[model samples]
Target: MTSPRPHERLLASMMRALPESGIVLFGADSVFPMIAIFAARRWGKNLTVVSAVNTIDPRPDFLPYSTMDPPAGHRGSYVIPMAEAYDLVGRGEVDHIFVSAAQIDAHGALNSSVIRMDDGPDKRLPGGGGLAMILRTVSVVDAWKPVHLRRTFPPRVDFVTGVGNLRHVITPMAIMTMEEEELRVSSIRSGDTLDKVQDATEFTLQLTTKESGLSRAIAEPTAEEIDCIERVDPRGVRYATEVY
Candidate 1:
């Protein structure tokens, strides 16, 4: 009967946002793939998990911290080439995609390339692999970042790695959605406030009007949700990259 931890709550929130049934493509991030797998198994939602490693509908016994782990593809149904996976996305066969970014702008554009600093040399990051194409082609793209800070949610990203079809940007503090091509605070996470979210964000939040959807708050993880999360991630791999 212990309360769900911060990372567990975050995982439950992300899992609840997933579609009931569709092909969900998980990026290279560690946590998102775990959520997708949990959703697929717990709800029996007919959800198909397409891993970044090109494993189609993998049925791993336990959630792997890294989607590339061999256990992630253990007892899988089929293995498709990476090219074919992207081709499916381009053909609109993919339903949802989970991606991550080092920096996300108000326009929902993602930056995973490099961070330009004024006082120091440019800090290079791992470039977005297939993010540009997948984001544009996928019907729904949900992006997540473990840490929420002003630097992470900037007014504008230094470089645009991907921009299209970004529906929601989920963070530990809040969930921002695209409205009129701009990111707006859709729902503040449990135990978080609008002030805290605004203070952590770099852009001016459009939460003044009722239509801005600032009144909505993310629901806390239910007992069932927490149970599912624990069952899938008994080793707590969901906390592999979480910051809070």
Candidate 2:
């Protein structure tokens, strides 16, 4: 079999970093979180993946095209009402929360709602569904985006839907984390260089005087991980077409 793509490898690494077992919360449309749940299960890490409206312990055999729509014959352990989920978030009971960002600034604040282009309602983007509470109370918040562009990793986002509580920001080219309220490049894919990472981002990366080298090498996905991803995403919708 061929090797996993760069993005896949990055995502797999992110998934591996999750706690071995706990109550994890995944975004409705987040791809990596779902994949990570499947990975954790496959790796024998007992975890309950909580959706915004349901608790998926022992996730479905077939991955859903969207979190709101589960596959045929799939069942969740119990339904998590919106109110209950929000309460859990408010209580800070959720171990980890995974979210996808449209725009993330240096302060780790994210803008996933409202048209950031001009601030008006003309092009209203998808408003923050549960990010506000999730960011405020979730112990760990991981944000990711499929795209790697200058506009995506801006110095500052125009609008803030969720502020603070960002732990990691995984992208196609690198893995970024906040340091001293500023975004720092922590790791880079094998083919990606410091110059490329800097070109794609707007913030000044803190590379020197770090524990790891300038760019922490991102390892390739193992065969077992590839198999898990294949089984979880049978239609290959998440992996195919090089799209999220």
Candidate 3:
């Protein structure tokens, strides 16, 4: 199997930090989190991966590339309506929620609503399918963006689909969490520097204590983690999404 890509490695790093057992929900169409669920399962995390379209606890090989596609085989253990799936969030049963981001600000506010470029405003995005409810209900909300660049990580978002529940933001180069309601760098991907992360982010990012003349070092991806990604995504689909 080939090596994992930057985003895959970042996802694996974030997912590995989850507690051993809990109900984890992925955004409707995101695939990298799906790969994390499979990787967590492979490592015997003993957590349930729930989805409304496909089956719960879906096998890696059985999973499809997009939500619009049909499950290949043995999709999952059970199927439920999308409404019922969100009900889990309402009841506070979900421990962690991962959603995609069109734009994220320094305050962890997310904008998956519409794209307003300098030339002109774009059409309203499909927006967060059920993310508003999840944000209000779940304690731990994570935002994942495949593209890690200035345009994507703007200082402010055009709209706020959800607010005040962000725990971490995972991008191709780094993993960030809120520190005192502001974005702070927690861990960076292997070979990536803090300066690189600061440059990519449009907002000012708080450095970890270690980065600010402290006697500690930020953690980077390990060999075992890259191996885990290889095992979970041997075909490199998760990594390929970064390019295409």
Best by TM-score: 1
Return the TM-score for candidate 3, rounded to 2 decimals.
0.85
For candidate 2, lDDT tens digit of each residue in 182-205?
A: 777788888879898888888767
Q: List runs of model 2 lying over 4 Å from the truth.
A: 118-122, 208-215, 240-244
TM-score of each: 0.93, 0.89, 0.85
| lDDT of model 2, residue 68 | 61
Order of quality (lDDT) = 1, 2, 3
lDDT of 1: 0.79
In candidate 1, what are the lDDT values of residues 57-173, reduced to their tens digit?
Answer: 887787777777778776768898988888898888898877888999988899999999999999999998888988888888888877888999888999998889998887878
Error of 3 at 215 (Å): 12
Which segments of model 3 are wrong by more than 4 Å?
1-4, 52-54, 72-75, 209-224
lDDT per residue for candidate 3 within 110-139, as digits (tens), equals: 888888777876768988776677777886
What's the best-to-worst order under TM-score?
1, 2, 3
> Which candidate, 2 or 3, has the higher TM-score?
2
Best by lDDT, which number? 1
